[model samples]
Target: MNHTIPLALSIAGTDPTGGAGIQADLKTFQEREVYGMSVITSVVAQNTIGVQDVHHIPLDFIESQLKSVLSDLPPHSVKTGMIATPEMMEMIAAYLRNQSIPYVLDPVMVAKSGHALMDPASQDIVREALVPLATIVTPNIPEAEILVDFQIQDLYDAQRAAKVLVEELGAEAAVVKGGHLKGEAVDILYVNNRFYTFPSIRTNTKHTHGTGCTFSAVLAAELAKQKSIVEAVSIAKKFITDAIRYTLNIGNGNGPTNHWGYRLKNIPTVKGENHHV
Candidate 1:
């Protein structure tokens, strides 16, 4: 007997350390019970400490990889991270224009170590050509500033930015992650003309290398199961929070979150969320 499973695709860079990017994405997909596919945009030589080097894949090959998967597997949901260039963003944008499945866009700009992952100019293309196609846009505060063109200094600012991503940039919804901020790990979501506050206790640890990639990957996986945007993001929040809480202390510097931590016994996954309308 054969079993049908939800399929998810991640188009992004590679983290050789297995902490972030394609590796993190695949881990989250597998953990979420989704079949995972990947299209690598660049090969990055990065570890817990910092990025050592990067070799971008040829644009033609990138497109070829996309075509190979889209024509064959055709994922139930799709997501993107570190689509580094204007040309690449445009290419992906063209393919996604007609996509009806859930598309979670993690606007990856800089690495956790402050290495630039995307071209600074690609911000315009991401706003103009890509964000609108997103089923949901997940941006940490820094990325939110670039996409929304303002400083997000606090929760209100994050709330405003989340609203801008959906109302102004035309994303179906947006979640402005507040990891860069102080206090509780509060993420503000704006969708369907309302706001939601998902707060979980901040783990005092440095093993959060691939938090964004893993979080958005979970969103894609949950959405592939046909869960609503709020439900998907809520689940993503719990997964990332739990993953961070357990803390995988493998690397020397900012290490990776525990991909399987959420499944750990006696781990109080996440707290309840609050609504804001």
Candidate 2:
């Protein structure tokens, strides 16, 4: 029997440590039962401890990679992470303009270990050129502040930031992740002028590396499977929660989340309903 599975693509940097960036995306996609493809944007020397250095791929080569994948096996959904420069963002935005697939933009700015992953100058370019093209833009507290030009202190502030991302920054939808905030891990999603709050119990662990990339990758995978944005976000939330709950205490520093946690015996479900996808 010949089976055709949905394909999800990640246009992002590479994390050799296998915890974040393209590596995380591919792992998440596979776990979500979608075929995964990748276009490397930058080569980063990074591990669970921190990012040591970065080597950006040339612009022409990046474009060629995009063309090579998109022209032939166009993905069902696409997500971007760790775009290191403004020029790369510009090119990606130009390419995404002509495609009609779900685009999840994870504005990866800094690493969990406080290392800068993207150029500070590219923040504005991402807000202007890339955010507008995203089907849903996911940003943590600091990233949200940079995109909306405001301070996000609490849940209310996060909600406001979500609105600003959709109404002002031109994103079709926005998810302001509250992982950086105190208490529960609450993520607010704003789309079609409606708000949805997904709150999960915070796991007190230091192994949550690549969570942003993993979440966005899962979202893209669900969308690739034709699930609604709301469903996709909800499922992705559960996925990350489980992954964090079963943290992998590997490296000496902040280790990585367990990517296979969803398949564990105790994975949570949404509203007592099993997530079939």
Candidate 3:
């Protein structure tokens, strides 16, 4: 039998812990039935507790890597995370400018261990160069604040931030994640002048490393499968919720979410039917 599988790519840094960055993205992509590819932008010596050091790949080498993959086997969708410098972001933007694919941007600024992953001065370049090139920009509360230059104190603030990301920052769509907010975890999406809100019950656990990367990766995978932005976001939300609910209790500090949790759980084969795993 001959068949074609959807391909998705992650252009990001490496997390040796296997809980975040390109590792998390590839895992999530495979879980969603999409073939995954990667272009390493930086290498980080990191663990669940914190990042100890980082080695950024040279700008020309980064471009060469992009060309190597893009020229030969272009992916159906692309997701980016942990691009540490403005120069790197600019080069990536140039490469992605002509490609017509679903581009999901995870503005990963800080790690779970309170380590900064991006340069402070690169925020503007990301907003101007990368954000506009993104088909969808996924930003958490703090990342949204940096992009929109406003404090996101509540749901209303998140909604405003999503709009600003779409209108002001030039992203075709925006997702303002509410994980940092108290109570239920909610995410607001703004696209085509419409707003959609997804809310899920919060899970009580410290094993929540790589959540942002997982969420955006799932979105990219779904997009690679030709799912609409709204549908992709909805499914990605559920995927992350289940992944968090069944988090892997490894490491002394925050651990990684279970990437295959959704598939392992008992799900209804038919609507209105109950099943157990």
Candidate 4:
């Protein structure tokens, strides 16, 4: 009997704490019932408190790692996080430009402890070489603001930025996370020329270490299983909400999200609305 599971690949940095970046992505893929593969871009010496140091893999080695997994495993979907340099972005983009599978981009710029993971000078390169290749780009408030080059004060701004990510930057869709907003955490998604909102009651916890990576990874996993775009986002949203609600307090500072939180009962149902704004 030949049995196979959907495979999802993550190209990102590594976290020794097993919270964010490649580790978080792999955890998400596993919990979502997909086989996970990884290509490490950077080795981060960081824990919950903050990032201490980072060692970027050589570009040639990075390319080799990419080819090793992508060539043989051939994931059904792929996502990237912590693309620190322009050269790394371009190399990954070149390989993904023609792949028909879903490509989820988590624009991981800063860590939970306010450490900069990406180079400041590489923003322009990211927009030009990466944002366009994303089937869907997931950006929290700060990242979204940077991508759209505007201040986002409310849901309207988020919707506008989401549209910009799709219409102006050429992503198939965009999710402008509203975590920075002061009310219910409402994430707006722009896809198929329409806007949709997925709102969850704010979980007042500092353990949202890998929320972004986990969200995007679940999106990729669901897509690899052949779920529709809307379906995938819906699942991803619910998964993250639970993970955040029941966060893990392992590290001294902002801890990691509970990857298995979805297993718990009575996860409040978060509904999404379709809007024409």
Cα-based lDDT at residue 55, candidate 1: 90
Q: What do the candidate models score in CA lDDT, each in turn?
A: 0.89, 0.88, 0.87, 0.88
Candidate 3 Cα errors over 4 Å, as ranges: 1-3, 113-116, 267-277
Q: For residues 1-277, write the lDDT of model 3, one tens digit per residue.
A: 2227888999999989899999999999989999999999999998888778999999999889898888878899999998888889888998889889999999987655555556668988888899999999999998898889989999889989998888888999999999999988988888888888888878899989999999999999999999988888888988898888887789878888999988778642211111221
- Candidate 3 global TM-score: 0.93
Per-model TM values vs. the true structure:
0.95, 0.94, 0.93, 0.96
Q: Which stretches of candidate 4 lie over 4 Å from their true place?
A: 1-4, 113-116
lDDT of 4 by residue, 148-188 (tens): 88999999899999999999999999998888898999999
Put down candidate 1 lDDT per residue, 1-277, tens digits, no spaces: 2226898999999998898999999999999999999999989998999888889899999999999998888888999998878999999899888678889999988667565556657778888988999999999988899899899899999999999999899999999999999998899989988898888888889889989999999999999999988889889998998899888678889999999988885555454355656
Better of 1 and 2 by lDDT: 1
- Which order, best to worst by TM-score? 4, 1, 2, 3
Local lDDT at 209 for model 3 = 90
Top candidate by TM-score: 4
Look at candidate 3 and tell me the lDDT of residue 69. 85
CA lDDT, candidate 1, residue 132 = 93
**Model 1 lowest lDDT segment of ten:** 265-274
Candidate 2 per-residue lDDT, tens place, 1-277, comes to 2237899999999989999989999999999999999999999998888878889999999999999998788899999998888889999999999999999999987656555556667887898899999999999998888788889899889989999999998999899999999998889988888888888889889998889999999999999999988899999999999999987789977888889987775754643122211
